[model samples]
Target: MALQILLQLIVTGLAWGSVYALIALGFVLIFKATDIFNFAQPELMMLGAYLSFTLITALKLPFLPAFLVTLVLMTVISSLLEMMVIRPLVGEPVLAVIMVTLGLANVIRGMTGLIWGYEELQFPKPFSAQPIMLFGAAINQAEIFTILATALLLVVFFIFFKYSRAGLSMRATAEDTSTAFLMGINVKRVFTASWAIASVVATIAGVLLATFTYLEPIMGHAGLKALPALILGGMDSVVGAILGGLIIGVAENLAGFYLEQYLGGGINEITAYVIVLIVMMVRPYGLFGTKEIERV
Candidate 1:
């Protein structure tokens, strides 16, 4: 109830929210471009974390170098999947695409287990260990960096999708793939670009998350946590993803903190779903989702 405690909680929420937003953004980007709910995204995130960890720990690479390498590698992998597997499946049944992505997720997860082994590993502490104080609340340097990095990425994405040619093509394709193709937008290329962008964001999210939680092949389940955010924000709205993520993140922190005293513990695990249920009751199409209309 103290003002400082509330501030500290909010800072924590923002950090976690940034992570969720990045993860959810990946989902929204892919779905917007391809209408494919990439169930493999979580696994891709896990792969990002593992690859970065390996580069830094095993190869003795510097943090910046390793992070950059991981980003490029993951982008290539995601782009390849889109070009090889997803591109070929275009115009197929929606369920089939969903199932294939889910299968690919499992395949990635299994591969990660074989390579990384089934253990929780720590990412190297590359950020400063010192905690910065703001308004009588202490925040870790890593947390500060995470917030800044997330914000910077969001801004860059806003500019990209707003001003860049590729971003415009993505928007056009999302609006109407056939129309975009007719206009010479290269819809297939848009799909591949979206996946590459999603992979980059997921890798960034994964690296940040590894700083907070122990990294394991199963850690990719973090995507499940972001799904409700994706729904709450509007599956097709990128900005909605950002808003939804913050709301869910803050709600989880506040509810977990206060409710733990009453629920015995771990209520945060279901907070996103609870929020989703409540939000859907009020706005079935989600806060920013487009509603369909039909004339009979």
Candidate 2:
């Protein structure tokens, strides 16, 4: 019985963690390309989910078509945002740019609330609700899908970054914008592509998350939960983000199950943050992050 409970928690946690990984990847991708920590990522995820909900429920589109359309729409929106809102701030102070991102987050949140209302809505499930038994643990089909989707995207992105021309250009730009431009890479286009890719990842994560949880303007708060993962994996490391997400997810589930009984019911809610705090103290750069030193 004890073993079964542990297995269940592990499986469930992985699913949740995979969603975190996807969202955190969005953070890493944009930062890698533009050196900007986008505080609006979560809100972007929320917007994507809301857009999906509208497409599926109101527009009566099929799941695959709706999903594809949502990706396209998100890509376009992110690119446009990069061009209009972020481009002007290119030479501005980092703090000022960050403030803009926070402002952008609020703008997205407010617009979502005005359009969708504050009432919680049920997101249409793309997969069956049936529980799949895996080694005596019952996992929701949607959860399984989330895991698979994350894996698939990871593989796709790995190939993209490893071999594709655009991917190589983005990588070069990430390494050094000045050098990349000297090499004839279009730095501006790379920035736009980075934002577009991040938006697509956010959309997938948001849609997967809403399948299991209630959809609301506040749903983007879940992105905050991924912050631990981002910090744990290293703010700038893609692989670190994935592993950090899984670790946080499993830790949260384990904490909820065993520690919650002794502490309180909300232990899981704060578990990731607590762990991140500890990690920050021990290794400020994160487990997989590279430490930088400045000679001043």
Per residue, candidate 2 scores C-alpha lDDT tens digits across 1-296 of: 78888988887899889988888999999999999999999998999999989999999998889989999999999999999999999999988998999999999999999999999999988878888888887878888888888899999999999999999999999989999989999999999999999999999999988887879999888888889999999999999999999999989999999998799899999999999999999999999998988799
Per-residue lDDT of model 1, residues 177-280, tens digit only:
88998889977788999999999999999998888667899988878878998899988888899899888888898888878999878899999999999999
Query: Model 1, poorest ten-residue lDDT window?
Result: 1-10
Number of backbone collisions per candidate, in order? Answer: 0, 0
Q: Would you give me the overall lDDT of model 2?
A: 0.93
Model 2, residue 203: what's the lDDT? 96
Instruction: Quote the RMSD, in angstroms, for model 1.
Output: 1.2
Clashing pairs in 2: none
**Model 1: residue 33 alpha-carbon error in angstroms:** 0.5
Residue 212 in model 1: shift from native, Å?
2.2
Q: What is the C-alpha RMSD of each candidate to the true structure, in Å?
A: 1.2, 0.9
